[model samples]
Target: MLPSLLLLFLSIPLTTVTAASAAPRCTTSTPIKTYQKCMNLPTQGASLAWTYHPHNATLDLAFSGTFISPSGWVAWGLNPDSPAMTGTRALVAFSDPSSGGLLLLPFILDPGVKLQRSPLVSRPLDLPLLSSSAMLRSDSSVRDGAGLHIFATLRLSPNRTRINHVWNHGLYVQGYSPTIHPTSPSDLASRATIDVLSKATEMGPAVPSWFRTAHGVLNAASWGFLLPVGVTVARYLRQCTSVRPTWFYGHAAVQIVGFLLGTVGFSMGIIMGRASPGVTYTLHRGLGVAAFVTGGLQAAALLFRPKTTNRYRKYWKSYHHFVGYGCVVLGVVNVFQGFEVMGLGGSYWKLGYCLALSTLIGVCVALEANAWVVFCRRAEEEKVRREGRVEEHQVVKASIGI
Candidate 1:
């Protein structure tokens, strides 16, 4: 019995050794998060996988993706708090446009990700880069035709396992071209993001779907669709002499209603900004305010409208026309800016808007040409009548011999 017990004890340690040796060193199959988009992003797909080893206080992270660009820049980053790119620690890799060789560096995404300025490559939060612990491998061969496949490993801050960690990761890429310099900010914006949660399907507080839907519908309808419609009515419909008061009333009614709707949409945008703590669309917000103020001035002008016979009427007409057109231009521009802010840039929303505006412009061009033709005919007829009257008066004077 004692010999059998000794044999069992010896076999246990041997079995443990074999199991440890066979354990997979890299975490690949089970990723904590994934982001996939059918859109033609440079990094077509990305994933995050991690394993924590308590013995050495090491956190192994695998940030891997497929880069379609043969050159330019590709990056993945972790944001400790919010998903905004400003506060992130990123690992960037690219084929140096100047050298034609791969270059990898760590960058801190601060002061926002911009396309005009260069990125600052350094450790964020003073985290040390464990150069010895890092490994970057890529498949750049034509036989692999799947494009550039990059797999990178990074060491996190020491004792990261003990701290409760909440993370979100983002992927960004810019394609290489002759005009695009490596040091220059990318002309093309390509990016995606996903939350890394400890528990699957768990997420932070999100803005309600209904609120977002209302905001989009209201703004698109008011600023993009209705404001242009109002402008068209004022410019073209009012030209019909038969309509007279009808055209004026229609113009006023449509302008008033559109302005009111736009005001509501603008208010909702303000509320949304407040709800979102760290997000701000400065250009969109500024343009929206300008549109609203111009629109309001137009509305007030109606209240103080002067009679046509009044001398100041000419001045009012000039002011009203200027402000009205200005409002329309500003409103349309801000709507496009809003699309980009919401990540709907280059989307079908923008395409639909362009199509609608183009149609309106075509109609205006046809109507304007017809108006000029009518005015020229009327002026020529009046000139002929005046000449005939002058000839008749001369004939009568000569016949009377006086």
Candidate 2:
């Protein structure tokens, strides 16, 4: 099991690298028109293609994104000051309310949008946006039947090389107003810096990739694997006469290590939540909190454990067992939730976790069956010994009476 876990951990970096390398590159071969340079955006499986004319200081660009729903909206824009949603001159595309046809309109995202003070109504941009158009075309590459493309021409200030770009998608619009998008980590971190002259691009500020990976690994190992293993050890090992008090020590040590690791992972999670202010995983967070609290209580119970001769010892034992098992269940469930939160629901990381957990369960089942067999055999032997003693007593009594 340890070797399997190590292999899984080592493969994490490789998987991340492979996924990044596999991102589709942008190309100047759109069905509408051709472009000079192109690059893939960092999030949302989106891409940008553009032709920059330095002499005229004009840019012709196409932004492509998969539609999340039939009534959803897609947007791409330039943030003149910073790579953030606020203060962006954006082009939003959605189905027109009047004709049910594709509509592309410009809107300036100010601080009000962030505050959600009112609905997002389209208005003229303050920048020199020459012309804008949009189209919905059938795309086999996308999960949805169609893809959204926004084409536009803009005149930029002379000598301007780099620009901050922000893009996002939403699931609904109300009476010609595009509603706020989902507050997922991907949605919140959907901005980048692009250089038109050099055709260079860089992802905007977000949580460090390494930190997220470390958080997942630590939690999965501690709450997901080690805690359950410790429970199994305590359940079966203590039954053997040879391992008696040694089993208790081993169980305590394993649980302590697991709890300590889980606490660190939980702390990392809290830090991440604070870092990404708007994003929330309510269920996952709740589960983690519950598991951590239960584990902590279990640890504390050890200090106040009642002696075997005390009348309340049975109650303490019951409490310890109940809390310990509850913690294990919560931890395993939250581990799966963690995978989904990290967007690894269908990845090999999840598969590896499942395999490890399944192996542990199988081991427990085998041990339980063997224990039952051993218990029944011992009962049968004790019964036979009692019957033999009774027969010998009867024989001695008959001889004395004769």
Candidate 3:
């Protein structure tokens, strides 16, 4: 619960990070030259237009992407080796420091760039390029938001009709070097394979929505719902003399089920993380890992539980209470973090979860108040019985003395 409170405080600002509005499609007409073919790219609200000449395999292309800010940089590139970005020979465009005009330079994205060992620098691409140029445009109807267009003419190999393309935008440039781009889902998924011979385009693989939904549901049920209920049962129900060991069994069953479901959910999260490389949610991942480890420890402690009459029973109970509550707190907090990480901060799913959790907390509060009332009543009855016995004893002593 303490962890949940802390998470609530931290998550207050996450609600403001809404998704960007839709971007307009790419326009066929350009100020300089016209393209024969054009297609809207899948991610980052970007688009590509090109004209391929079959005789000499000359290709004229224009890639357009929106700027995140005034000082940001945009890039478009082709990878001859594979469909990924590691080996891509790219052309990056940014504002020139001297003239405040558009500056275009070629860069090769190597393994070092992916590993972040060194800053990205400009160099000549290995591809056969006839010419390259770039310009900034402010037309909202053609390209929504601040936009930049990269134009290039490259000579391709004979009979080459397929090409892999990558494009991305960044928020900063240190001196003349462009810094690493944002690692959000949209940014990392900005690659596609396009057929120069036709209008066909295949986007890069993305994590399925159903998989993410399942992960969120399972974790929410286990960590967010069931675990708290189990803790509540143990805390309140066990006090009833009629329930006795029944409460213990109920608590154990609920906890075991919750833990099992949480294990599956945690495994799914790990799989998703592996599937989407170069994307990281640091706080969410850390909280998840801590909760999982703490939950596992709590589960394992049941095996070494001390006997009821044992001298170590009190210490064992203390350990169990501390760890159990800690796990519950971490689980609840991580569930909220999961919502933010999945970009469902303002979705109906979060609202439903919040309503259910609030209901549970309300139930716990009512039960706590009732338990206090029962305790006070019993204590008062015990005191009255003691006073009655004392008065009767005094009456008997007085009669015997007379």
Candidate 4:
């Protein structure tokens, strides 16, 4: 298993993209679409779109409009069903007349989550997701900071970005302008769209594109590293031994590492989605969360089991059996889904997992058959002993009566 993990690291090729130029004055992120394609010409709904290059191409952004305010703009995007839009300078709505569709402005929202914190743990962000680039909420707005610089904290949506560990090295594009626009409502003057893509240009070798690729590599590596083979090893141990100690330790360790990588990787997925909202990315986020939640349940069960109690001590077999099986099933299913999302739909990874599981199943069946044979032989021997004892007792009772 350790060898397989080590090989996994060496296997996935790493790719990075650095910026080629400097941040131009009044620049927006490239492949900047007009309001037309953002609407999806014919059957237009909420749009979410993006591209996944192998860390070679320049950063792609859709919304290109720049605000000219003296103070920095406080930009935020939320579902109206969430925080309803008010007329405050901190909030603005961009509603298109033709579509009657409202979207938030700018490139800020991340995937894997959306704007809500109710008891309902998860909900589809419902934005139209597309590959390459996506449209923003047409009804959203940005309020100027004293009408000069734009600054705001974007509450992340798991569906928007892969809420990965990339936060430590976040790619933010902050712009400070000289004048404030009189036409704007806030205290400041001029406005501009500071795309993170341009920030990549300014960084020389330190580009935002590299972060994007890093996010993908982590996602692939996490999903690939375990879950498939680990699940098989853990479950196979169950049919062989009632204690399932090997199964327990193996499953726990794999899950711990798998989830850590997944958490960081999933965060990147969310970031990708937020950078570009689309169905493929959103589905990826949803599955990632599902895996995380199930893993948590499995971990919690292991934690709460009363290993010290008398009954538990005796029934450790039962606890181990159930938990082991559950982990195997969930882990296997999630691994399959992860591979599909990671663009390895028909790749060697799929073949390897298939053969490994099939082989494990065969081994488990053989072991179970052997156990049953042993059980049957023991039952027959016990029956003979009981019959002989009954005859002896009958003879002794007759002698006593006489």
lDDT of each: 0.58, 0.86, 0.83, 0.40
Question: Model 3: per-residue lDDT, tens digit, 1-402?
Answer: 989966864564353232222347677667678999988775677888899999999999999888786677889999996667789999998777666677898999998986678888888889999999988776432122577889999999999788888899988777778888876556766776778888666553344435677799999999999999999999999999999999999999999999999999999888877655334577889989999999999989999998999999999999999999999999999999989777677889999999999999999999999999999999999999999999999999999994
Ranking by lDDT: 2, 3, 1, 4
Our model 1 lands, by Cα RMSD against the true structure, at: 17.1
- Which of 1 and 4 is ahead in lDDT? 1
State which candidate, 3 or 4, has the greater lDDT: 3
**How high is each candidate's TM-score?**
0.56, 0.56, 0.56, 0.42
Provide the lDDT at 109 for model 2. 94
Tens-place lDDT digits, model 4, residues 141-214: 32221111111223333233321110000111123211111221111101111223222111112224444446
lDDT of 1 by residue, 156-274 (tens): 45554322221122223343311122221111112333322232222223333345546766777787778778777788777678888787778778777888888888887777665
Candidate 2 residues lying further than 4 Å off, grouped into runs, are 1-206, 399-402
- The top-ranked prediction according to lDDT is 2
Question: For candidate 1, what is the TM-score?
Answer: 0.56
Candidate 4 regions off by >4 Å? 1-15, 19-284, 312-324, 395-402
